[model samples]
Target: MSLKFHRDKLSPLNIWPGFVDALTALVMVLVFVVLVFVIAQYILGTELNGRNKAVDELNQEMNRLSALLMRAKQDINQLDAEKTQLSEQVVTFEETIESLQSQNMTLSTKIESLTSDKANAAKAKMSLEEKMAYLQSQIQELMSQLKLKAIAIDQHKSNNQVLEEEVASLTKKLKSALNSEAIKLANYKSEFFGRLKEALADQTDIIVVGDRFMFQSEVLFDSASAELEDNGKEQLKILAQTLKKISKSIPADLNWILRVDGHTDKRPIHTKQFNSNWELSAARAISVVNFLAQQGIPTKRLAAAGFGEFQPLDTTDQDGDYNRNRRIELRIDQR
Candidate 1:
């Protein structure tokens, strides 16, 4: 017989075994729940660690951006300062130019006034010249009258000797005076000639334009080229040195104006550099003027002019006839 198992049939040892089995299943279910909870916790912890690393990287990027922004701001400030300085310089330059313009205008007005005065003075000079001419005529007339009177007095034979003596004395005085005047003129010519020769002694194309040192059409320049050769420069150097010295000794009344005038042959130069004789002549003049400038002469005092075969000494084209046309005339004038 078996003990009652609460309205169910059972073996003698079945109740205990079933109770143990049910307890074991319940323990297994609890263990599975714990394992699930551990897995979820581990996943959550890993995600939290990854989020923290991302936040740290974002912080570093923000810091880097901040540094670049600061540098850019400093650069902008420097540029703005430079711009302001440049603007100030421009304003100062404009003010200076305006001041110069006003001063120039004042000088122009003074020049106009002086020009009128100079014109009026020129008329007065003409009047003085006329008076001097009249005086010279009167003096000549008085001399003629004196000669006639002397002739009449000498006609008497007794007084002839005395008259002759007086005439001889007058003649000697006139001769002496003429000799003195002639000597003065010769001295002037010699002085000018010496200086011009000294100036042009070293130059090839330059001719000392006086009574001495002969330079004709034959030896002055290249037939076609206005370009002065090495010899030409040498000659120019001597001339420049002489002029520099001569300028120091010129009369105070003279304000010497140095002009380099070029002349060319009648033939045209159709090269790339020059179109006509005028251009070639002009280039030669400029070349001479530039040489003078290089010799320490002021640019303001030097001027260039070209006379293209127009003012020839000889009318006909013959051998050596072009000498007059191919010339570099260094002219000195009181300006």
Candidate 2:
């Protein structure tokens, strides 16, 4: 009985814990296999979805291509119709031209024969005396026409001369009257009246300076400020309008030059806008030029220069001579 008891203890019932552990291990292995299968299914499904999207895009592109092909076919049909119309018109025009050419050749032959008969008749009938009389009559007619044309030409020239004289007289009288007012202002001593040629001298501003109509710098602009005053702007407006008309009369092919020179007082100007009298003078000159440009003066014919304190009409740096350095000079030339 004792041996049987020991055998029972050694049997399967005593090793039940070992059997349970082995069963649990086998169940865990099965669960791991199921997890791997689930992950593989998800990956395969994602790949299929991506392939489906690519196919849809390809189909859309094909639809667009098919539409473009249809439009191309329509354009080709239109071109074919136009080509056929042009070909038919060309054929019809060629046939008409050929028919006209045949008729023209026949008429030309008949005209040549008739012209020859008429020329022979004329030659046979024309004696030297008759020819001389015909020539004399022709010459007389030509002389009469030429005399009339000459008379007309003389009349036109006379009219033109009178008109030019009248224009000159009017302009001179206007300028002379303004000069009288300027002469009153000339009492400033530093201020120059009349034209600016005297102040500008041989500079580019005075292309041709006449001594009789000359005035110094102060007649044209403000001292050290190239800006034209109201009085100065008005003077320039009249001059510019007059000169524009004069320039047009000279001929369309001619070009002229007009320059403005800005002279400044001796006082220096140091600021953000102007560094010295040079800049001030230049700005003033530019102002006058711009003012003239607004009055229909062509910018292509305009130029501005700054003389600074160098172009003093009074030749002195005295405060009283401040007016002498301010000038806007106008010049003209044919180039």
Q: Judged by TM-score, which candidate is best?
A: 1
Task: Please give, for residues 255-309, the per-residue lDDT of candidate 1 as tens digits.
Answer: 3467777777676678877888888778878877887899977676688888887
Candidate 2 Cα lDDT to native: 0.58
lDDT score at residue 52, model 2, on the 0-100 scale: 58
User: Candidate 2 lDDT, tens digit per residue, 141-217?
Assistant: 64565556456545545654554555455556545644653453332211222334343344442233331122244
**Candidate 2 lowest-lDDT run of ten:** 185-194
Query: Residue 130 lDDT in model 1?
Result: 62
In model 1, the runs with Cα more than 4 Å from the true position are 1-192, 198-221, 251-253
